[model samples]
Structures are given as structure tokens and as C-alpha cells.
Target: MSSPLSVILTQNKLTGENFNDWKRNLLIVLNFEKHSFVLAQPRPPTPAIDAPDRDFVALERWDNSNLSAMCYIRASMSNVLQKQHEEHQT
Candidate 1:
């Protein structure tokens, strides 16, 4: 018999100046992987008199039958994020 697959629960940071573009790319990645996710926005402990805080996209749930898909999603997302980081660095 084969061992059961493990579920993946992870978060992707959504930062920098191009939030909309980053989010759109991440959505595409998730859709391609057929994975459902939740968008988590950072909230301050109290009303911030200054600016807003950081945010993230969380993949907290997955289909147990296809855990391997998460691996592909993670790799693709990592690549996308790295590209975005490099672009911002320039």
C-alpha cells in the first residue's frame, strides 16, 4: 500500500509597489493548479495613524487526492515572486 499524501499550507507575501499585478499573477498560478485560496490582508492592532501594513495570500486548504499539485504551484509561485523582486530591485 502507498502512504497518504501530505497537505500543503503556506502563505505568499504580497508586497512592493505592484500589488495588483502580483495578485493577478498569483491568481493565475492558483487557477492553473486548480487550488482554492484566501486573501489575507494585514490589520494593525489599533487604527494606524500612519500607513497600512503588509499583506499576504494564504493557501490554507487543498484537495487531499492531489497533493502533488501543490508542489508545482509552490515552485511556480516562487519563480514569479523572484522575478517580481528582481524587477523591483532594478
Candidate 2:
């Protein structure tokens, strides 16, 4: 049997001070053949933030061969982050 491969898709956001400005960036990190790679998604670049830094991020891993793996991985990561944020609010 072959070992499973994994990939991570994440979105990182930087928000300005006074919560007045925001920008979101997407990244993908893959793990294959015992090596890792980081790629920036082909999307619009984040605009400059006007205030102090805040971060929002997510990460997900999945078996590379499965159909719809990318979608599941992304959703899992987002759900995890959402739960974390909700916990912090309490």
C-alpha cells in the first residue's frame, strides 16, 4: 500500500488598526515525497493596511488522491478557524 499525500490550503488576512481596513491573501502548501512547498494563489494582492496588525488564517490537510479533496480540505480548515474565533469571544 502506498502512503498518503497531503496538501494544505490557507487564507491569511491582515486587518488594520481601528478595524477600518482589511485584506485577504490565499496560500497553498503541499507536502509530497518528504518535501514541502509554498505557493501563492493567483489572486489579487492584499492592499496596505492603515492600522496595527491582526491576523486570520486557516490550514487543512487531506489525502491527495481523493476526489474533491481540495474542497474538503479548505472547508475543514475554515471550520476549525471559525470555531477558534468563537471560543475566543466567550
**lDDT of model 1, residue 25:** 59
- What C-alpha lDDT values do all the predictions have? 0.38, 0.28
Model 1, 1-90: lDDT tens digits are 011111221243444555565456555554545443322222223434453433111212323313433343343345556565443311
- Candidate 2 pairs with clashing backbones: 17-51
Q: Identify the candidate with maximal lDDT.
A: 1
TM-score of each: 0.29, 0.18
Residue 59, model 1, lDDT = 19
Which lDDT value does model 2 have at 44? Answer: 26
lDDT of 1: 0.38
* Cα RMSD for candidates in order: 12.9, 16.7
